[model samples]
Target: MTQRSTADRAVGGLGPWLPIVLGMLTIFGPISVDIYLPSLPALRDDLAVTPALAQLTLTACLVGLALGQLLVGPLSDRFGRRRPLLVGLGVYVVAAVLCSVSISIEMLIVARVVQGVAGATGMVIAQASGRDRLDGPRLTRYYANIAVVVGSAALVGPLLGGQLAAFMDWRGIFLVLAGIGTAIWLACLTGFSESLPHDRRRAGESSILHDMRSLARDRAFVTPVLVIGLLNGAVIGYVSGASFLLQGAYGLTPQQYSYVIAAGAVTFVLGGIVAGQVGARRSPRALLPVGIGLAIAGATATLVIGVLDVGLAALIAAILAVTSGTALTVPSATTIALARRPDIAGSAAAVVGVTRYALGAAAAPLVGLGGGLSAVPLAIVMLVCTLGALGAWLAIPRAGEGASGD
Candidate 1:
């Protein structure tokens, strides 16, 4: 009998459920943010807070997400995926309950922070778990499949939130979130197995800071980190401001705005599917430009649409193109970041998360800098971010040049 390697055995244990489990784990972060959006206005009125104050609830969650990943990365590397993931999910359910019962804006904000921190464990570990089981093309496909699952969650979150809002008050949304969290927690408890065995984990042991410094010095790693990081920032900036552009400026209703979001989500899923298949054959370095070019084209078109006051159809088309293009790079860039850093997979994943959340937070504020009245702010943000991603790609070594992470 042939002796199976540890990775092969681990994959066998997880079976066909690895991508689905990891995808569901990752969904909490985005779903936590998006599910409460439709309830924002009501949440503000119920607590008698300013719109800005109510929005702080969102800002709190985002900060928790960033910090939580930073804090959890090393722990996951040390303690393994299952423990941290389970604890976090448990806390998330509790946090959801807290938010539902909060009597003041301050209370809600605090609860959201707890919720975000708890939800973040799911995201980082999901990425690292993929690294634990596979490499090369299979790893690429795994990440892409996660992207498809995440995009679908984004599409469903707002739709579900909207329907819930119509039937119940703002607080009920949190209860519903709590229920979803409970179900996922139970599923993970029964179905999820530890992918990172202790022996493999011990072999790579090192200080978190040391591992981070090592990763930072690697040009191969930094390239994709910056690429995906900036692209995510741009896409999030578009999302933060799209409501303003469509409703405040162009006079579309909230329901109509949601339709555009759904369309973008669909395109995003398509891009992920296509990119995963293509990336199975091409190296990450080779595939980066294709993604970047699409992003640039969409950004430029968006800029034109904003400057010339193009009608809603053209604007939506351009924005959707940007969404799809950004999605195209998710698997390619991530494979580049985590593939060669198997020993430090958790920290490597965390570095990407830190950049992603930090830039994402920065980009959201930029949409309001132009007073939320024109598409110009959103367009500028998209163009600048895509240009940043383009520059990052250019910094990487050419095909003939050496970079094993590829």
Candidate 2:
């Protein structure tokens, strides 16, 4: 049997196990991101860095995620998905262990960069594998399913990390992550099989430099890619600023902060579920605005409320609206982005992936400009980001809008 057929049988033959495996793999990045959030405050004290500098740790991870996908996407196209994933997860294991042992903040940052780079492989590969089999709304549903898993991780990882850090110290968080990496690595070896076959592999490929050029030139490809990136970038912005916004500005305790964060995350999960249900019924172009609208309204309201010195209850309600809106928007954009060119889904997804995280990484510093923890600064930053995302999405033409065919 052909490798593609074998993979199809392996993946398509099993019903629940396939998505479960994909879900686990998808959650790896979220775990890497959220698991460390609760530890940021403790690390600030231990590393003796300013709060802004401490925030760079998260930025570093995001940068790593962006760059790693840039490398892994093409490699997966050439070598198949499974091999690079194994290598990436293996690297993550080492980085996680190194993070645990680091004596200085610089070392920890470097280790996190490595971990982010390696951890992103799972994300890119899981996407490529999903694209190899599914398309259109079906693929959107798959992404929604993965989001639920990843979203749940976002909810749980921080709480777990917070409790762990509270009791055991921040180093323990990294150690636990290392253990999770080991388990995921083993799962890759046993349960997961290659989806991209050699016969289908892109032959005589351009240099990585040239592939980037080609990606930039494809407008149909680039539009949806940009849409996904910008939307995801907005989420990353929220993540980058969330800790400071809650703990530093609002004066919530770490444990309390996790619960607050959990509330936002639950909205994210709800958004994904809603997207899966409605993505087919609504045009992606139409849905993109919903998220942008929510973000704009939420951020703008928060800005006004913060200016007026609103209390916690009001602030939470506004933020939840934005979160809920983002949840609805992301999956639909992703489904549209990957609709065409089933063959290069890895590279396609990677393009959007890189843009999202890269923007997210930048969002950290941008939001820090006014004041790291203050209310007005964060509200303004989120307002601009959400508005920007809305403009970007509106600029792009959809499949049926002007284009003759899909």
Candidate 3:
């Protein structure tokens, strides 16, 4: 019989704490983005920039996140997860401080890009580490738990940011983020052990291009990656545009918008819990159609409501549906994609991360391009993205064929 790997041993030794720790690490992206959202209007005025330029700050971060994952994922595959993670967290702390002190919109945009690059390390490694230890049904459940943590952070980050913005200025928010990054850095230094052992590490000379080619040829992997990208695009597009829609167009305050966004986030948590329970009894593949269908329904409702000029109640219900669908879809799709090649989990996780963030970066700007005041543009873009996700899901083979089709 084969002996257990370090990751397997760590899973047994750490028990419940392992997933929690990974979840905390993975939340860096959401917290960083969401916490700054309430300040976007203030930041735009303070920096004396155009609305489009202000939106670029957010777009720049998404682009950096996508590019950073592409670099760090392959490195983690060869060098192990711990050192790169620690270094990235350190950079994140410094970049947050830079953002706090930025004197102009250009400076703030550049700082956000660097901050996102550093934060991507945590996002990529956390998922890669999960893939290191778990597989099959267990992997699906682990991802569900991670989704709950992410959802909780999404719920809290904006509310806290709005409160902070009310109490102080936007600069205080970045200072708080700096403090958070510093704490996470120390935790990683002291508490986290290297999950990928030397024996399992990819050979130094292995070609990343070859790995990309291999993954591209695998329809199972490609389909899920596309679906993940499109779903995330819809979610982030909502996030990017919601502040302007609610606060600028609908005349809601930042505090009120935060409460609305937080309420919507709760549905995401509910969906995650439901997916966790359902995934155990059914194949993860079976969950895909239901998830995509809900997303389509939600997006369609949002478009219709926006065109009709309905009030916030109708809009909130539609947004809740979309977020819940994502909660159901992302974990299941991620588990299927990452399980395809356990040895190259980091690379696989990176591909998914890059695609998701890249599309999200594209979607953020589209919401503002048609004019920042209307929710109609945001609704339309989300509808298109959800439909794209559904199309990608359909491209995969039937449920019993296996996610990887190996």
Tell me the tens digit of each residue's lDDT in model 2 across 1-406.
2543555765553255666667777877778878777678888998888998887887788778878888888888778888898999999999999988988889988998999899889898887788776665677777777777777898988777767877877788889989998998898788777777676777765566666666676666666666566556556666667678788888988678677778888988888887777665655556677777887898888888889978878888877877777777777667776665555667877887887777666665676675655667767767777777776676666546553232
TM-score of each: 0.93, 0.86, 0.88
Best by lDDT: 3
Per-residue lDDT value at 316 in model 1: 87
Which tens-of-lDDT digit does each residue in 145-215 have in candidate 3? 87888889988887788788988788888999999999888887876778887888889788888777778
Candidate 1 lDDT tens digits, 1-406: 1212566685464576556778888888778988888899999999999999998998899888888888777788888888998999999999999999999988999999999999888889999888887777777877888788889999998888888899999889999989988988998897788878776563444777777788888887888899988999988998888888788888999888889889989987888898788878876555678778888898899889888998889988888878888888878889978875787788888889989887877888898788777788888888899999999888876556776432
**Candidate 3: which stretches are off by over 4 Å?**
1-7, 10-16, 40-55, 102-107, 166-169, 247-253, 307-311, 368-376, 398-406
Model 1 lDDT-worst window of ten: 1-10
Q: Model 1 TM-score?
A: 0.93
Which segments of candidate 2 are over 4 A away from where they belong? 1-14, 40-57, 103-107, 243-251, 280-286, 372-374, 400-406
lDDT of all predictions, in order shown? 0.84, 0.76, 0.85
Q: Which residue pairs clash within candidate 1?
A: none
